[model samples]
Target chain A: MTISSRSGSPGPDAAEETTVIPVVPAQDGADETTTLPPIDVPVLEDEEFEPQADRDATFRPSRAGWAARSAVWLVLAWFVLAFPVNFLSPFTLGVSDVSAASEAAIFAIVGLSLNVLLGYAGQISLGHQAFVGIGAFTSAYVVVDLEMGFWFAVAVASGLGLVQAAILGAVSLRLTGLYFALVTLAFGNFAQQTVFAIPELTGGEGGKEAPRPAMFDSDYSYYFLCLGFLAVVLFLDWRLTRSKAGRALQALRENPRVASSYGINVKAYTLLAFAVSGLFAGLAGALMAHHDEVIVNQKFGFQLALLFVLMTVVGGLRSRSGVVIGSAFFALLHSGHLLSLLEPVTQTIFRFSLVDFITGTIGLPIEFVALVIGPILLLLTITMYPGGIGQQIAPIREWMLGRRFDRHAGKVTEVEVNDVRA
Target chain B: MNLPLYEQLALALTAGVLRGAVYALVALGIVLVFRGSGIFNFAQAEFGTTGLFAAYWALEIKGWGYPTSFLFGMGVAIALGLLTERLVIHPLRDSSRVTLLVGTAGVALAAIGFQFWWFNETLVMSMPKINEAFFMTPWGAVVTVQELITLGVLAVVAVGLALFFRSPSGLAIQAAQQEPVASELVGISVRRVSMLTWGIAAALGGLAGILAGPYLTFSAGFLSFGAVGALLPGFMAAVLAGMRSMPGAVAGGLLVGCIEQLSSLSILDGAVPGAGALVLFVFLLGVLLVRPQGIFVGKVATA
Candidate 1:
């Protein structure tokens, strides 16, 4: 210490000056004596703090994109296959029976419309069949009474349906799930009463027959026509799921609060979703009216509404394929074949009509299979596979690629399942 | 089209109030179930129908009943209610509100189907005419003993339920609704409480149905009709009450009944022929606009 250092050692100049400590710690806990000059650290300006070049990379779809594309392709292929099958098959699948296929297609349309609202939007509508009825009634009136061309009738019917939906949407826009459901129920009943009351417009209890379009002279042609409509509806559905509006609707379904926070006009979107859904429903009704060559008030009663809800729920509300599958299954069952098949068994067991046997045994109608089964399936899906059948299949496809399905690996939590439930 | 003012007004009010009381009773039954549990009890009318049919069987068909067919019908209704609660509602205690509501609807449909299968005929039952002695000419309007009984029963039940909720067991029941998990954790047995609620609600519905049966003849489709009547008023009441407060439910019911009666006397009688339905919609819309939470209760926090 007494020895003179390079700069100073207990010198008067060093003692008079202030010694500044370094803000940063030394790498090692070693002490060394050295003379050092003052250093100036350069401060980077705001312009120097730029994001990485990778941040400007071109947009890329997530893994969900490929899965969605495959789904779309699969749907298109199914439609292509169904088109010929609908034309060739007769009422029964037994011998040239296209009736069953055509009926399935018609129901498929109804189910799809319901899927748009109940499935994608997560709104429960008990009055969907009312729209169907309105479409049928309007189209029937136009085609049969107004003597409008079939396509013209369809156009007019769809327009009327839009108006009906708008009015209903306006009235029920403020209502939440259950109250919304009740209002729709009341409207359905009111429609029925009005139909019955206005015998001049509707044939009332006697019912009225609708004329088939000239284009579809034969059953095969009618089947093809229905298939065409179904195809268009299916395409529209595909487009909807892919479109921005569809995503917005889906966002609302997932979490309206979150969606609204992102500046989505919740009411406008809800109304739009409802209107689009009604448009499809109306189209289905118009097709049905022309297909059956009859439109009855009874066709759109509360029971039909219940059946429609059941169909959508059973088909797996989140998937278009599920809706179609559910609809087809229900239509086939409704064709009375299932009941006929069970006739012998029913006779032996209860000695009653098939309706009685089915309804009495389970204390629920066959139409209510969805009601009885849907919740269980939904619960199971919620617990085990929260994403429904569509999302569940992705992992299998990924596994086939010799890769572990790790997209949702750690992100899939119990809370996510509860959130989906909500 | 041009009836005397006094006559038209009196008749309209009379019909409205009388029908309104029936609506109130039916609605009260629905409100009970809704308040106890979140379910709308779509089968409330069917419960009434079951009672009516049971009364018919006991009084007219079997002819082995010491009591009047009316009393017998009430008994059968109580039994059916208990059975339904135990068999159906009890098992579905943990179901979501929508599921439960749909379940009730299913019950309704099954009940209707059963009635058709069993009865085979839709013939209406003819009960003994209610005596007119109890009726008095108030403002030249005739009010029947049946209507009085309906109003009285509604009052007693409403008051009784209010008192019941204040008791220790009622507090447990309320606790079950407020915090079902916590109540369960505390060994309160949520399922048992729900079953009890179902039983009580069903019995109230059955009683209402039996009382209303004599006025509107019993038939297979009677319950279906009754369900509509019950649904409108009950739904209105529940919505008005914010689906929580019992007092709110009662007040909502009375208000609906009165409004319906008053609307019948108004100019709207011609425009919207469904006066009762119109009144319900208007009131529901009004309440939802002004106070969606309901009169006495606050906003419906759960559903």
Candidate 2:
């Protein structure tokens, strides 16, 4: 049928019609005498083949559903804001705890940055620690040595991230898959051993003292600033995924050859994604440096990069909420304060601190909890649940978003463990 | 030209060769696993570190004889390799190569954690050198006995691999690597070959760690990112072989080593901190950008 024959909706009459797919009998069609009648196969109705836009009609919740969604959103806002500020909450948060919360928010931003490349672009970056590290050092140097304000420092850091990432993206034009991974790995080592070692830039062993911005000096205010940045990042990420370039990334990632055939500039779009990812990472890094007040090179090591990857993977590749949660979980875990908070739960569960329990039962020291837990979660995430935490929480998320809480809501439409290796 | 400058160049060259030997040893394992499984195993370095740690415990803590400790270390390495193949690789065999790479990385992380747990109390663990003597060159470059022995070991391993590839079982491994389904159809158990390949690779990694550990003050993840960050260099060496050729991997390792040693030159070191890593990073980028197929490998259009 021609395009003109298709309608917005199909009538019942179309259901009666059928098409047949040829059924070849006998091995290699050797037994021609045993030919059988053609079998009927289902054919797509004109309405079924309508434009993709018409098919994905948005779900409109009822009045009560809308109210519930509003309530849920309000709770989410309050939880994120008041919990960190220790205002209008059951318990007050200390300054360091508030700082940890800020770090968590920054980590969520960094995780989102990785999701753009690994999730949407189907590209891998093993040297992401370097990306974040460069941003951290850049911002620190700008703020401390150059004596610039926080806003200018963040801008310069993000620009550097964009430029460096674009250069790396250019490399991806020639090399991909494992080769690209190797290059990133090399770059990470370079950043760690060489770039971070520059005495002037990193400010030697004590590191550069990246004091908080004048206005947002208190932990409470800085937390809000980070939250604001995270909100901006989240908004940008949402817009990118819905934008033309984002769809192009998804298509090219599925099959570059076909995408190129369809007139997509594979190199240009991939570079755009790299720039976007790098921008967010740089912004997050700058935020993190200021969060600590004293930035050091040791924080962003190879293991940190590895943790970032597995955390994102474990969070679920393309799921925004999942990645953010996973990133926050790791950031909290890394800071050690999260474990202390969990001590009460562990005491009730195992009569000792979680670290002691792990050492006594699992034979692992407390210092390496994430080192062990992260991997187990990663393996489980990839093998059994490719959707990660996002997939697991999808049904609840759908319900909260004014949709029916269907049991199979989070069914993995696509199972990709970092693409199909080209 | 000044004689001192000539001596410095000679020393750098000598150091590069010795360093490259260790990289080549690690590269062999990388190439083996990549060929047999078509997955880039990031845990290769951990296998080395694990073996080194196991040996350290035996020789130092338990006071086992050197020969027995060496055997124990190799045994541990083989066991760990087999376990990895069974636990992580087997479960994710049908997954994407990237997923497999992630799985191997998980294995590496677990090993690193275990090492830290066991050796957290110990600081700056050092492996005893096999021999104390050193051979001095005319240019004043000192070559330790351990370095000479490592070079000799590499030669023997290369020759052994050359010979193995010619044997029946070796041919089976080759067949399995090149065409797993076809080899299976012809009665070759691809599973056994896979296990064998990983085992061999792990042993090689272990040997590299045991030999190289003496050259530096070692710790957990030593081969991966410690004082001797051999993993990336080893990978570059494998990339130089186009991630395929066995003999080419060793040669690539030596080349990478020599190039890396260039950063130790006083001129570069004085000019910048971490000059060696900068040189390595530039070299890796140059290699992939310039000749991704490697100098020795034939070029073919690929996805």
Candidate 3:
């Protein structure tokens, strides 16, 4: 019910700053802004008082508090980096788990790529598997046949991804809403059936090898390399979303007509979003090709497209941390490590192996766990927890940032993926 | 022996029409749901697949009579439609159309996953045709009695729907769809009408799956991505109908089918890989660009 004003970092557009949070409750209908304005003027004009008295009351952590927070932050960082390699850890993890961690990072990249389209631009692509698959095949062909290095293959793949997305962006201009989604779905099928079936490019059904980059051949080292790439992508995403282009995309997504009227080039920003999404997808695909050492056409099916959407939405659209965690969680589920990780907890609760219960009593295979449970989770997320894991963890993130842990700090009013009729 | 060009065209036309029958059925279902609830109903094709699996289980696994199994499949599909309307669609009715679309897609994925889980042991499965007899057309393309039955069913259903619209309950459905608030004031239960429309659409989809399943071996998402892949074509057909007109849907389905068959011509055989899918894609884009209002749908006056 409270409307919080933003502090620091004044944006170029003052109007945008005022309307950014449009968080006033719609049901109330009574405008509360006029009733209780925060008068910044001094209250006690007759009494002598220190000028900085109000500012001194603001919560700034003491030196010891800062040290404790830093220690906790370092532990969290170590858990992410060191846990995969079993360095100073209690649990035993084989190389396969480490490799799976690499896949998780790659999945996070794909999820972020989707967030650009679905979250930022409000464009849903049902054929993202095609986008990623083309990248995978392009990378593999460049590396294996042309004898190009990994970095060059990656560049080519990302470039090709941009080209393909531009082509689709043209179609998207003609079709919006469900019609555009249908086109993407058809494109995905076409890619799976025709493009990937080419014996020359994809090596037919057998697939083609994509060698790991030189000096990072070991699994542990490769894991670090994936993490480094993930960090770069994260940084790029952060910078992009904070730029004017990001603001333009948000404007277009809300109302293209109004945005265009305000001198924003809706078409250009939309294409930019598509280009960025495709680039990230391509980068992930190239990484995936080398991670598996071989890329096959079958891996980029419609199911994978659904999986990508699932991760992005369930991760909570537009929430970077949520998308990363959701994608990694699903990746772990796909790799069958999630069940094993939960085995001890389930055993303590249910007095039996939960993994065994799922595979034995339920007759669901480990690999199929994500497919079966993911949709259920997606349905629940959309219907009940619209903000998803990101919204749920907002308070903690605020607390970590040395702010008050207000439970409603990052609440999303409503997911605005509707009425995209053009 | 290579066929003459005329003969090849004849084969393509005949095959296209036969295949178009199934597309028409699927399109009818899509149009119905779109008209009734304004949902794209991504689960429309999955309903058929789920029904086909149910029928397969009853006939193959449970050793039920064919007629009984077919009815059971339709029953299961209708049940699923009602369940979907109650659980996912109704709750999301006030949400955005895209959210409803995503919800239906989620329903579809769940159904596909359940199919995979239930029928995992049987790696490949096929339903028996109603009649095993086949006759060769003048173009040398063989036609099965099963296909003839499919065509016959499409005709009957189309005519039946036309006549049903003249009936009282059908009028209620039409009224509710056009003006739900006014219809409610007039004592028509809008909720029941929605359930009825979804049930009928699901039945139509189930019919398509049961008929099309015999054309090839079936698996999870058969009508979606298998040899009989009808989801995209069905959507194309619905689009060609402007997602509203039933008769237009039938015509659109036939037109889309024939257009897709153009890829199978002898001249274009090896030149284009996945020619059928590619042809369909291009045809869809062209239709959307040139006549997005639909080739078959007549313009209606808006107030």
Per residue, candidate 3 scores C-alpha lDDT tens digits across B47-107 of 9999999999999889999999999999998898998999888877777777777788888
- Cα RMSD (angstroms) for every candidate in the order listed: 13.3, 6.2, 5.6
Docking class of 2: medium
List the lowest-lDDT window of 10 residues for candidate 2 chain B.
B294-303
Model 3 CAPRI quality: medium
Ranking by TM-score: 3, 2, 1
User: What is the lDDT, from 0 to 100, of the residue A75 in candidate 3?
Assistant: 89
The digit string of per-residue lDDT tens for model 1 on A97-118 reads 4566677788999999888877
State which candidate has the highest lDDT.
3
Q: List the lowest-lDDT window of 10 residues for candidate 1 chain B.
A: B127-136
> How much lDDT does each candidate structure score?
0.64, 0.82, 0.85
Q: Which regions of candidate 1 are displaced past 4 Å?
A: A1-104, A332-337, A341-422, B66-96, B121-144, B184-187, B217-221, B224-228, B258-279, B295-303
**TM-score: which candidate is best?**
3
Candidate 3's C-alpha runs over 4 A off are: A1-57, A62-68, A344-351, B166-178, B301-303
lDDT of 3 by residue, A1-422 (tens): 11122222122353343343333343233455556554423323312233233332366777876887788788889878999999988888889989999999999999999999988888888999999999988998898899989889999999999889888887788788788888888899888888888788888788888888877798899999889989998999999888989888877877788888989988888889999999999988888999999888899988899889888888988889889999999999988987887898788888889888898999998878898999899888888777777888777776677755567756765555455762
Residue pairs in clash, model 2: none
My TM-score estimates for the predictions, one after another, are 0.73, 0.90, 0.91
Clashes of 1: 9
Q: Candidate 1 has which clashing residue pairs, if any?
A: A89-A97, A89-A98, A90-A96, A90-A97, A90-A98, A90-A99, A91-A97, A91-A99, A210-A293
Candidate 2: misplaced stretches above 4 Å?
A: A1-72, A348-352, A359-363, A413-422, B1-3, B297-303
